[model samples]
Target: MIVLKAEVFNDGRHTGENIAAKLETMLSSWGIPKENVLCIVRDGGTKMKKGISLLIIKNIDCLSHQIQEKFENEEDPLLWWKVNSNKYGILSPVAKEYLVTPPTSVLSERVFSGAKIFYIPHRNRLHGERASKLLFLKFNIPSLQFNY
Candidate 1:
C-alpha cells in the first residue's frame, strides 16, 4: 500500500469538494491516471461517500468493518469469496479485490506515530531531506534482504 499523503488537516470542515480536490492533486502529483484507480474504500461518512461519488469510481465498504459490526472475531471475507468464486464466475476476481481492502487507516496512523518519534525535541532540528531519508530507511530497510 502506497501512502500518498500524511498531514494534518487544518480546514474547518471536510467537504466533498475539498476531499475530491485533495485526491485529484495527489493522483496528479504521482502521475497516476484516474482510470487506474480501482475503487475507494472509506468509512461511511457523509462527506466520504459524497467525495467518492464525485470521483466516478466504484466504492467498496471495508470488510473488517462489516465483520466487526456482526461478528465477534476477525472473519476473512476473502475466504468466503474464494469459496464462492466458482459460483460467481466472472465477478469473482472483482469481489476478491474488494474483499482485501483494509477496514481502517490504522496502518497509516502507525506510520505517523513512527514519524512523531523521529521528530522528537532534540532531533527536531533535522532537515526535511534528512528526516525523509531516515523515515524511508526506517520503514523500508526491513523489507530488503541481503541474500549474499
Candidate 2:
C-alpha cells in the first residue's frame, strides 16, 4: 500500500483529470503497478470520464465523496446544510464556502468523522449507526441559531 500525500483541489485546473494523471505518474515513478494502487480522490461530482480513467488505471476509488453527495442531496436541504455547517463550523469563511461548494479537502472531515465514530462514546454506549444518525439530527437541528 503506497500512501502518497497529495493535496487534492476542486479547482478547475487541478480537477480529477490532473490528479489522476499525477497518481499514475507517481506510481510509475515509484515502480508500483497501477493495479496495485488505490486512488482516493475527494471529489463527489467527478464526471464519469475521470472516474473511468482512474479505474482503467487500476486504482480503487474512495467512497467518501459519494457518501457526502448522498447526504447533501437528501430531501431536506435545510437539514443537509445544517449538518454540514455544524460539522464545518464558522471559524473560517473558506470552510463556509466549502459547505456550499465542497472542495476536495472536505474529505478530511469525513475521514475524521469516521474516526470520531470509533472514538467518542455516550453513557458507556458505543454510538452505532442509528444512534449516530439520531445524534447528528438532534445536535445539528437544535444547535442552528441563525443571526438573521
Best model per lDDT? 1
RMSD of each: 15.1, 17.2
Tens-digit per-residue lDDT, 1-148, candidate 2: 4566554555657555676676666666778776664445444446534844754753333544333455434466555556665453432345445556445777557656655644655545655686667656644665676444
TM-score of 1: 0.45
The candidate 2 region of ten consecutive residues with least summed lDDT is 58-67
Q: What is residue 27's positional error in candidate 2, in angstroms?
A: 0.7
- lDDT, candidates in the order shown: 0.70, 0.55
- lDDT by residue (tens digit), candidate 1, 63-85: 44443433325767677667766
Q: Give the runs in model 2 whose Cα sits over 4 Å from its true position.
A: 5-12, 15-17, 45-55, 59-61, 64-148
Misplaced by over 4 Å in model 1 are 67-91, 94-148
